[model samples]
Target: MLRVENLSKNWKEFRLKEVSFKVGSGEYFIILGPSGAGKTLLLETIAGIFKPDLGRIFLEGRDITNEPPERRGIAYIPQNYGLFMHMTAYENIAFGLKLRKFQREKIREEVEKIAGILEISDLLGRNVKKLSGGEQQRVAIARALAVKPKILLLDEPFSNLDPNLKGRLMREMKNWRKELEFTAIHVTHSFEESIVLGDRVGILINGEMKQVGEIREVFSKPENEDVAKFLGHENILEGVADGRSLNINGIRIELPQKACGKIRIVIPPESILISKNPLVTSARNNFRAIIHGIEELGAIIKLKLSIGENLLSAYLTKASFVDMNLSEGEEVFISFKATSIHIFE
Candidate 1:
């Protein structure tokens, strides 16, 4: 329901250069990028808070590039949960409707409905300052939704929330959007969030749109090295492809059938299997690699392995590590299925 074309904007230190993308009606589109990547600038530009140097923005086939923020029928929920501390949750949510000269009864009805949907009905009478971070965030979201905007632009709405609260909020958002058929563009730095919340994800880097596609497709086959690495492909190794096979540091691996070229192989650390011996299995690739180091990261253990001249990382459960009696300076065989190897040309 929204489209941006040739959008360009410049700031003191960062600039958006002809970035473009589209979101369909009722679709959950996420703009994912690292910090200082101009994600907020782009969102603000679309919201008409910052005028673009050059470009056009369309909503539902109508041009809104120069439309005023209020007239554009869009709601923006910023990262800081912008709520007026002086106002109570009910008043904050009713403010927009009041500004539009909506009737008092209508405003109350809308506010109550939104608060119920966001599960913040009891907190409505409390002042915004007294609410916890998650409560205030929910209030902000309720306020934004009360207006019934055509599109909702959320800039890291879950950034400040605890992991458990974030998960609950995400599920609530998904259910609310599905029921209301709301079109949303959420910007986030968390890959997990994008995968869970976005119907399609657009990866932005340095103001440039790198890749845009379904979550699984993008994760499975990233367009380039940067995108692959960004999506949690931590095990990167230089490899040469000969036909349908790849050779990396004296290890030969059969790949999915594709065009042949020198490529960099990206395998998720979790995909690598640690075995005590060369077990004949369905895995097409196996190699004997030395355990260079082992580090404990929370519940999982990261094993640094050296295969010939290549260094690779493997992630295993703590239980598995203990069961295998893994230690540094030990010999172990690494194995992975053919389909797990992602070859980027």
Candidate 2:
């Protein structure tokens, strides 16, 4: 396990504010935040590229706060892949082992093994600068794995790829993780990446660690409105809470817990189930809404609903939507369980 305690760094205008989190062995943890939120700085600190002004770093119960980057047993892959432009892929992969004074035959064997695993064996002889973006990524990963590091740190490594390629690489990352069984702390501003690759995620904003939890938990129930908005949460409604109900735009929504005074509620679009007819389920909230807008988003359809004075968004799979024949200006029944509601003051 890797543990970071009260890690803080002051770099110019940005600083990491007592950020702390832990990653279990072989667990993929993601640091999620927007641009300039100190995501890269945090990764660098953990990798020992930049020493934290305050904090302790422990890997498998061993304190390594003052260790140098080479001795930290951590591999960092920057956004640019950081491959030497003049060197071949094989040479890049062999650089670290050479520093460790591995025998020539041993380095070649280790390089070949990792390249085969990353499926870049065919490109090992080519110069890294000549390889495609995805190919370079593979080489970078192969080089990192060749060293057999205890932890891997990735810094927005997919930001430069197109959507389709980015998606393929994300899947490949899962496969690589399974085959290599390496611990990773991947930092990215993309929530989709976090959803696809992260076992747990920490939300960082304005150089502060806002929240950390399982993907579903953090995304569904954000710590505050800032985190909620950052996660692209829709249907954020402010209402008056009295007892076990909330009054929003004169619409009463049943609450699972008793609370009084002003409160904010977030209804995840996925949590709201839409049907042509009213659902006979145990959901506590149901509304007859008119579909004001329908957006075809490849595999998912986003429906803009008008429920009296409230405007809500709900997502449905393309197949289910096609089966229902939902369209703009059509009336549909939307139901969500009271427990699905995330209420905060």
Candidate 3:
């Protein structure tokens, strides 16, 4: 288990302000943030590579705020893999064990076991510089695991990987985590990665942690406008709330709950239904809008619609697009359930 309390770190142009969160024993916690969000800085601070300006970090119940990086008993796998190019894969992996003064036989046993687990046994004798990116990554991971660390800090582990490789590695990592039963804190900007690897996620923006919760909870209902926007909510509307009623740019909507004064509204693209003709369905909010743009998103079709003065996004399958004969500038009816809309202050 790991806990950070009001952790603040300032280094050069980067600052992590009041970052606080917890990772339970054997839990896979993902720190989600965009580029330049100080995710790596925060990880380094937690790893004791960078000392914090204020607050404390605890592993289980022991405070490690003042501990050195080597004394923290944590393994860190940075973005570049950090392998010695001149050394063979086996040597690179065995480096950590050597630092801990393990016997040659013991080190060889551990390194070989990890290499087999990572499926990099063939590359053990090969120089690291000759290895592919994925192989190098596996070598790095094997090195990190060589020491039998109590906690692992992964900084953008799969960022450089392609989609298919990323998926495979994520599955492999998940299985390894379960089998190894080690606590992990993975930092990434990819939503798919967070969804796949995280038991819970902390959304960081501009060095501030806006929301920390279970993946489904944070994805389905974000905590604020910024969080919603970061989560890919395209339709952000400003409205005046009157009890359970909301008026957005003259279009009145009925909400499932009541809140007063100014508020923000977020309607997910999937929640809005698009039809060629008006439906007699029970959806409370319906508007006739023109398609402003049509984007091809692999198997999905994303349509930008203009409703009154606001623009909303709708998504459907490519098959649906062909079935409906939809095109830009075409008029369609957009309907969304009142319950589908999320309102935040």
The most accurate candidate by lDDT is 2
| Predicted candidate 1 versus true structure: per-residue lDDT over 69-132, tens digit per residue | 9899999999998898899999999988999999889899889988888889999999999999
Task: Decide which is better by TM-score, 1 or 3.
Answer: 3
TM-score of each: 0.91, 0.91, 0.95
Q: Which pairs of residues have clashing backbones in candidate 1? A: 1-24
Candidate 1 global TM-score: 0.91
Which portions of model 2 show Cα errors greater than 4 Å?
275-281, 318-332
lDDT of 2 by residue, 1-345 (tens): 899999999988779999999899989999999999999999999999899999999999999999999898999999999999999999999999999999999999999999998899999999999999999999999989899999999999899899999999999999999999999999999989999999999999988889999998898899788899899887889889999999999999999899899999889899999999988989889999999999989999999998999989999999999999887899999999999888866
Best by TM-score: 3
**lDDT values for all models:** 0.88, 0.93, 0.91
lDDT, residue 325, model 1? 95
Residue 32 Cα positional deviation in candidate 1, in Å, after optimal superposition? 1.7
List runs of model 3 lying over 4 Å from the truth. Answer: none
